[model samples]
Target chain A: MIILNQSKLNPSNIQPSEITSREVFENRRHFLKAAGFGLAAGSALLLSRQSQAAIAPVTFKANSRQKISGFSKTAYGAGEKLTQYEDVTTYNNYYEFGTGKSDPAIQATLFKPRPWTISIEGQVKKAKTISIEDLLKLAPLEERIYRMRCVEAWSMVIPWVGLPLASLVKWAEPTGNAKYVEFISESDPQSMPGVRSPILDWPYTEGLRMDEATNPLTLLAVGLYGEYLPNQNGAPVRLVTPWKYGFKGGKAIVKIRFVDKMPLTTWYKAGPSEYGFYANVNPNVDHPRWTQSSEKPIGAGLFGGRIKTKMFNGYSEQVAHMYTGMDLNRNF
Target chain B: MKKQHIVFVKAAIWLFALLPLSRLIWLGVNDNLGANPIEFIEHSTGTWALVFLLITLSMTPIRLLTGQVWQIQLRRVLGLFMFFYACLHIITYVWLDFVFMWDELLIDVAKHPRILVGFAAFLLAIPLAATSNSYMIKRLKTNWKKLHQTVYLIAILAVVHFWMLVKKDLTEPIYYAVMLIVLLGIRVYFKYQPHLKSKVTKAM
Candidate 1:
């Protein structure tokens, strides 16, 4: 393990005001480059320990290889800055790679999401398997900045570019009997090591009520921040339900099934008492283990503080009419 | 035990104990604490606390198995480090996470069973950490042993606290729980070994 000598970390050299300045930090980056420790750029941002190996900074480029049209940047809700692409891609909770937040960022680099075929079956008029490329051809994509609130009470404002789920369901021509839409994620145990362990039932599944699926706010995201989805952030395709907790949005999905009954989601199946079916982002309804009243936005620093969590993640104005008569606390 | 050997062991323990804090400081200063730094700090400190507690608990069994009386000397260092990390964990949650809003914190403590259990575990660890010195052990005599027995309960509580905090994946907590159980099982086996041996002799 290469240890950067502590003597070289001169606090006086790095101006106190410039310590948090990203621009000034770039200067320090250049300085480290000149000093020949450029290789430790990522580790340099983190303090190096003698016992452990230095972690290489994860580097990924936004490859918007697919042409998406009719998608204008329509800003939505509270106008929080889109989380830094680096942070958004690196900081993930996709347990398919592993349970650790950073595990997906590192381990998912090798996952091949291309040549991916999704089987769209169940209660749809045209139940057939389709290639991801063919699905992309279904509708014009739109860039929607949606607030993704995790069940863990942290959140991110993500700039997602995708077609509306309503368009996909329209193409599938869902049967009148369809009450729910179930999503099954890709589960190759050889690639997705998390599948080797029963952290969750293998071939992760998540569901949305048919109306929720047809909601305009519900997006079948193909990219983020003008780039194709990073493997860690669910490459090729994923669901983005802006009004619900993040887990409701399954990643690396392989199957989209329109069903007659409320589908059993992976989390709700594992612990029904903890994770409810309609995992809506209701500040009034606290999770069994944690309060949902507030959320710390991702990329918020140590002193950068938390904000009051908005009901339905601030999309209540648009989607509140759907659950008019149901008790949110019970359904949550 | 040789004086020089004991000194070297003490130095090693101290250095090892300080590694997690040094790593945290490095991560904080470098601004490499990912998106949720408070959660990162809380988790890192909390994990280290359980790790140190497991290490400390293992010392008695190690001593019993190896017949190394000197193994007891390292227990204090590990126990103190466990308390130190637990303090950091609580401080981060209360100060940084909640900003010391005692009312909100209290309400949460009441509402969340995991938080309440974790708080109880931390509170129970206080007397054991406070009485971890040779002078206190000498003065308290048998009371010290009785008081320190709370460490086992604290270990169980810490594991449960972790198990409850996790959303779905119980793999990590399950691993910690198994480690704690094995460590305690070693002690129980040793405690009853002589009785089992005598019973075998009578049967023969």
Candidate 2:
């Protein structure tokens, strides 16, 4: 057994993040912690909400999911964990599965995703393809509750399990030429039914600038709700960049290319006029098709104007600095 | 037109037209619309617009095959309903989708060349709907035919707008495309190639 010592744990902090969109969001616990609530006591709420999971949450292969959490078991209560378990799993946004939400839930099982391989190539010094099993074995699964912001202006918080991209990057000795990382989804049409569609070319691809890829917020998520990620959530592996819109974080990642330039993403290529490349979850920048300032919270909430979307999806502390001097509006 | 034919057509047309208007009111009142209610409403109204257009296009074919000229009068009513639904569709897209998001909306309008096509189609139909009455038809005399001929182009654009928005599995838009093709084809064959016309014109 590979014992992970505290000193060996490379906790890369986002000290450089400028927090430009800092006005809208504040961590509930950070506020509560400042108000003198014990961190240990607050974490007990995670187990408390196990009963609140769902009337019938999907029972996957037991603990196929690893838990490499840095936090204590009692240190739970990240924002609404069950926000979209029912809706998200059933009604997903996996284009590989298909356009409609139910489409992915029904079709993704065709792919034998378990024994998958993620090709890690391009600008990195250690450019080697890593098997999914090896990747999971290298790091323990850590449950992190995160708010997923979709470009459609909807929000959901799920207890995601996986290691940080920062952790993985450290292991893969970088030569420092990698300015951006591009993720390419598998192009198996028989398995990925959406590949049959002429929507935006087959084998969906999304990318992140170098700084964004290394950011602490960028996660290589594997599971959710302490269970193996459902087929709809890109079983095996998916990227979870919390602050950016959902589309920016790719699913079923097959390749990680370290490039000198930013790769053209799927949504941006589909309609460059409508979808910008740096699709950050910025409320200020309105989509050519709709507004982004406010969002509809999935599950139970008021019909009209329930929650206002925050800039960087409340991840300004972790990712804001990546956009240093560039005009977000112009790039948007 | 026969006395009974006029009354029957007018009453039936009015009753059918009221369904869309009432459904619109119910949607607005109950807030049955989704997160982006504007898109849902736009899609719904736009669908009805195409439905009305198909109904309007079918009128001439119905009269020709059945040897019933009374069907021609219902064409105006269906055409007007098409314009009505189109107006709502455009209104929802402009007002809510835009949220009066004027600057972005203006940019979107300027950027998408297709929006201009859609706008032009809607604008042309306005005059046709405005001059749909017997009074305007009587006044315009020869020009009425010229003004209403624009609907063929309008139908094409509405289909284009639909095709542009839909992600894939284009069965619905393709169906509309096919329907429009059949309609325009019928008009062409009847006018230019009379030899292609079937001698036995049986009505469904």
Candidate 3:
């Protein structure tokens, strides 16, 4: 059992250096404002001039991400080089924003992750809606650096700060009838441009079996890189199951329903033949569109090529027992 | 068109056709190719190749509509540009993405329909690009037209390769598919409606 150190975790005691300098932050805002004016004046010139700038490496210093304090570091992904905070935040697959990898960073600027409430219902002993502020205080957050493998064959090592889902499950007090847990993400059409499109059904949903939810490796991520999550990286609260593909970590989640039966996840519903309910990181089971035997690390650069993928993304020791006697290829 | 005018136009085409490659190099040098540089390069080159393929296919249509013969002369350069970008795209995939891992590549080609179709499209473009020279065209004579006609097949395969690769949003691929269909459809319409063809010829 972990003991809470209230003083060490105080938000006000956060080191100033951990936060972006005010000058740089202000400059970035000014640059963005200038770019907006350029867009209004002559978009053609802006397009030609900023073509390369559009793909420039994003710096965390540009945005003043709130510093998350008091979380203790865990040995998750020890010795692994963490992917740059810029790449992890900028390159995302939050389909609610847009399909392009960089789209989330550009489009999610207006997304408001605060004042968010997750409704916990279904087979739980008592259904309740908890605000994001209340949820953060439920348990002591820990920074767990984990290998995040995407279904698209790219991977990242992210330092996620959050409490275990088991803690939340214990708090929810699920009844015996609860067999599965479904996560539903926010689908505000006004802020989320991708939701306006008919891509994969809005309010993206993902799920986990009852035991999987209670697993120690499953994290309810609220922050990354020692700061509150950037909007593009699923601000407020999101799920992070290190053993599964990154898609299993639903972003901007607003609902946690404990149900008796399996939930039809958004991706599974979109392409039943491609995505399966048990999206465990199985290297042997290739996605229908591409090979899953290898994955390119996000910050590996051009020549980094790809490294061989591992079973359960190298976390088989912890999560493989959950799938004992079951064929991963079928349940993949 | 006069000889000088045609030369000037050809030079402009050369400059315009090489812009995508130049832009890619500039981005690479500036380190602005985003988080996944290899994927960015692969996508940029592949999209340019498709754009050039569609442009090459449109030359005859442009001539048919405007009753101008000058645009037809640009087809060879346009087609070659398509092959050039396609080569870069494949090289990026093989050397950078796969790192010449022949065994994995073989498995990828065999297992994935998207890779197979894209590879087949590249292979088909080889013969067309090879026989594009004047000497080879003169030597092949009547058979040259038949060989070059396979460009239509290459375009179809390229479009299908893109369509298959996209995860869900088919908007971009659908645009390319529609463009290819319209280009091919124009020829089909002209073939079926000889009266319209004669009228176009009379106008020319």
Give the per-residue lDDT digits (tens) of candidate 3, residues B1-204. Answer: 888898898899899888878877887787767788898888778888998899899988877777787878889998999999999999999999999988888889899999999999999999999999999999999999999999999999999998998999886788889899999999998889888888889988
Report the C-alpha lDDT of model 2 over A1-332, residue by residue, as the tens digit.
01111111111100112112222222433565566657636663652332222211232334443444452222223545467455556546787776654446545655667789988888787778889878887665677778888887667777787877877776666666777778898878877767887876766888888777777667898877666677778887899888888887778888988788888888887878767888888888876655577665665432333466788888787778878898999887
What is the CAPRI rating of model 2's predicted complex? incorrect
Best by TM-score: 3
lDDT per residue for candidate 3 within A1-332, as digits (tens), equals 01111112221112222234545545655666677875645654544333322322234434558898799988887898999987888788888877778667766777888789999999998999888888888899999999999999999999999999998898889999999999999999998888998988878999999999999999999999999998889988999998898999998989999999999999999999998998999889888878999988988888999999999999989998999999888999
Query: Per-residue alpha-carbon lDDT of model 1 for B1-204, expressed as tens digits?
Result: 888898899999999889879978987999877667898888888988988899899887777666666777888888999999999999999988887778767878999999999999999999998898889999999999999999999999999999998877675687788888899998788678997545534543
Error of 3 at A255 (Å): 0.8
RMSD over all Cα atoms, model 3? 8.8
Which residue pairs collide in model 1, if any? A47-B26
DockQ-based CAPRI category assigned to the predicted complex of candidate 1: acceptable
Clashes of each: 1, 8, 1
Which residue pairs show backbone clashes in model 2?
Answer: A43-A74, A43-A75, A43-A76, A66-A141, A67-A141, A68-A141, A68-A142, B98-B101
Complex DockQ per candidate: 0.25, 0.04, 0.34
For model 2, the local distance difference test gives 0.69
Per-model CA lDDT versus the true structure: 0.81, 0.69, 0.85
- Residue A3, candidate 2: alpha-carbon lDDT: 14
